[model samples]
Target chain A: MNESAISIKDAALDYPRKKKGVGLLREFITGRFKKIPRKDRWFRALNGINLEVKRGEVVGIMGPNGSGKSTLLRVIAGIYAPDEGSVEVEGRITLLAGIGTGFNQDLTGRENIKLTGSIFGFDSNSISDMEEGIIDFSGIREFIDDPIRTYSAGMRARLGFAIISNLEPDILLLDEVMSVGDYEFRKKSRARIDELVQGDATVVIVSHSKSILQSMCDKVYGIHNGEIVTDGEPDSAFEFYESEKE
Target chain B: MGVSENKVLRRDGKLPFLSAPVKIMQNLYNYRQLLKHFIGRDLKVRYHNSILGYGWSVLEPLALTVTFYILFAILSDSEDPYRPLTILLGILAWSLFAKTFSNGTTCIQRNSSLIQRVYFPREIFLFSKSGYNMFHFILSLLVIIPLLINYELMPTQQLILLPIALIMILMLGTGLAFFTSILQTKARDVEHIVTIGLRISFYLSPVFYPLEMITGGRIPEQYAEAYLIANPMATYITMIRSAFTGAPLDIPTMNLVITFATTIAIFWIGSIYFMRKERKAVKFI
Candidate 1:
């Protein structure tokens, strides 16, 4: 009963750097004769990292660019398999990264809702049940039938957020998506997220916005160079983060 | 509250060979809804802005059939009345393999955005590619029915082999795709190499000519069995044509068995290769 909602222990992932000017033909001819060292070929995006977020806990991850924040989130979401260690999670996880992560641009907003809903493992009937709520929340009912490509960036973000939020995911992973859309939409999205958090859903947010981290997170971790620099109250994490920046 | 079971994500260890395909099939079944949506999206997006839409699927093979018909008519003195129908079937069958090979190679890279953002069985993209092309293949097959009627040919027992042949072609194409899609993500050149390989295979396959040209004494008769077994596409295309024309299958029973086994082996090997390489390959993509 005390099990954490998300547990990542000693997780490490390497991003393979592409070989320059290496074609399959050249590799076929020379591969037998050549022995390229594998050690220098990969850029490790996530180092040996351990994290635990208890059930109903709201956690924030703050880091600079290339600090492996998104990669860590992806590992937790099971989008990337770590080169070492493991990630275990309880409950249905939903990750909303940017404007439209899984959207088909050619599909209308309405169609994308169904498609994305299905991707999240929802049956069509449940997707249909949430369809109206999502459209109303997005506030783009007039353009829901138009192809999503026709929507503005804010509109697309609103639609993406609406679809995911209405699904009521048990574990929600947000990767810098809260900064999207205009002031009003952002306020509405924040309210909805607060409501979800109040319902005891586990939440993880990856962001550089200090205001967001302070307001939404119960605890914040500062990551630098694929390693956690601070794991404490938001003020200390931001203090370490700001010092690292200097 | 009860402790819910935790789902773990880690680097997969080597899977036992027998369980690999079964595990993949189970994963696919679990994601069947997404697969359906993907296939539907593939079909809809393909024909979205085009004027002729689905007609384009039939037109390409029909145009090829005509070109071959006119060329062979001028060159050869004897005419096989089933030449046009046979040629159309060959083109349709070959295109299924060719399109799947070419498209499936790039499918992973094409959907990199989706792949990076979401976590689902990556095989869905490859399967959806083949599934949608299979849809086109079936649609184009319907066009040949009128031609079959024009030739006064009705359904026969041999037609049972039609589905078998089609599935074999699909497995072969999907198997090849599974290998190339992962490789293509690592190196952009794999798709180009596949394109060249497919071009050579088109001339080597019996797309324009009858299988008889090869088996009917073009090569020594003894090696013909080996050739059919070696090149399952030849056996499949020949089976498809025979299925429609009701010509007795010229292939020996043993060769058919070996070819079927080879197709399954390729599919199995491809799935295993895909599952193994996919995690590493996505990093490069």
Candidate 2:
């Protein structure tokens, strides 16, 4: 309904922690009687952050480890609700977080394609239509009938990327997924990702690689200690990130 | 862009408890395919590496029936033509309830990887296990029913109640499953506790022996009603057995009335408890 694909105002999310020396049994027994034990600590993963991403934009989030990069993505993906504020999003979003995150190892590549496609909301007819293309793009047509356990890690990544990129998601969320497959497939995947982003689709990518962010993102946000320290063009964000590293 | 910090937390983002039934139904409709995938995956994984595969479904309960059949025969010092059939029916009913709760307890933990990655409703895991066990339970029935027909153990009039009894048992089992599954996420000991409870429950229910053994001579007449009413499994077992063996329903009408009420009540409470706890339980798991 709105041109902005994602809008967040003062959104905050906390990871709860149980107090030390309190056994799980005590917690369970007390919880059964409607007595919730007080949380000893609340780690703020995302804190008082405000941002907006417009339609058809590739925004990259560069942050150090444990700096809330993944948590921000999860909050936007509706996996975790913000504790302090609200997030409003429009469009169908698909998140590719890791290599083969949802695949069943015992299922064959072809069957897994069907499973993954259906989970992403594709009907049977569409899955059948995209099956051959996914296999062809992965270049593992010969091994498509074998169980996914037999595939190498790079091969699984190939298949995962092939299926995800083919789904034509409205908003694509990528979390350091470019560092996958061999040299050749990685180059091919980069080109494929470029093609996907070139469409009228908004993309939010999280990567630590400055070169990738500089080459791909229109705007880059540099985060440190759970706060956005730099929000500007890619070159300036990368400079801020480098300056922070020193 | 101008932005203001909102102080009041809007709990309106989530649907209220009264809409739980409608929410469950809508989720079932929207993620019907995902549910199917989960069931299909669980079934395939269970049978894929096993030597006997589907045979185990029938053989498991059948083996347990044989053990009890022999134990009862030796202990009671009597020969009954329909003894094995009666015991088989009891085991079938009890196993369905036992397996659903036991498996349902670990459904969330088993799928923790998927839970961490995706954003689907967590109850899908519990229902998947319950649905898969139900399929196996129904398949085992295919084996038992033929033996029943061949032996001519059919109680024609009471046969109408079997479907109703089976549905009630399913509701009760799933309800307990929802409650325990949420608890199990927080404390791993819930599974062990449930396993022990089901074992004790099996003996308390009328599995190997008929209700007559308990009500006739084993206990005082005054305490019989309370005993039977306390264990809803006993009522379900009797209902199922009477459907085939023409045995008289020993429990009172009040007990049956209470059993039905408790069955529905447990399901309602279980679903509400699961829906509320599941969204937050993922973090603990």
Single-chain TM-score of chain A, each candidate: 0.88, 0.87
Instruction: Candidate 1: list runs displaced more than 4 Å.
Output: A19-34, A231-235, B1-16, B47-51
lDDT of 2 by residue, A43-109 (tens): 7778887878998988999887888998888777667667777887666667877767678898889
lDDT of 2 by residue, B25-110 (tens): 67677677777877887788767766577787678778988899889877996555678888888898898888888888888877
Give the TM-score of each candidate: 0.92, 0.88
Per-residue alpha-carbon lDDT of candidate 1 for residues A119-158, written as tens digits (9 for 90 to 100): 7777778889999999999999999999988989888888
Candidate 2 backbone collisions, by pair: none
Q: Which of the numbered candidates is closest to the native, going by highest TM-score?
A: 1
CA lDDT, candidate 2, residue B98: 88
Candidate 1 — which pairs collide? none
Compute the DockQ of candidate 2: 0.26
lDDT of 1 by residue, B1-285 (tens): 111113443333454365767878887787788788889887888777665877786788999999999999999775587999989999999999899878898999888877877677888888888899999788779999889889999989999989999899989999999898987876678889999999998998888888888888868987887778778999999999999999999888989899999999999999888887788888766
| TM of chain B vs. native, candidate 2 | 0.87
Best by lDDT: 1
The model with the greatest DockQ is 1
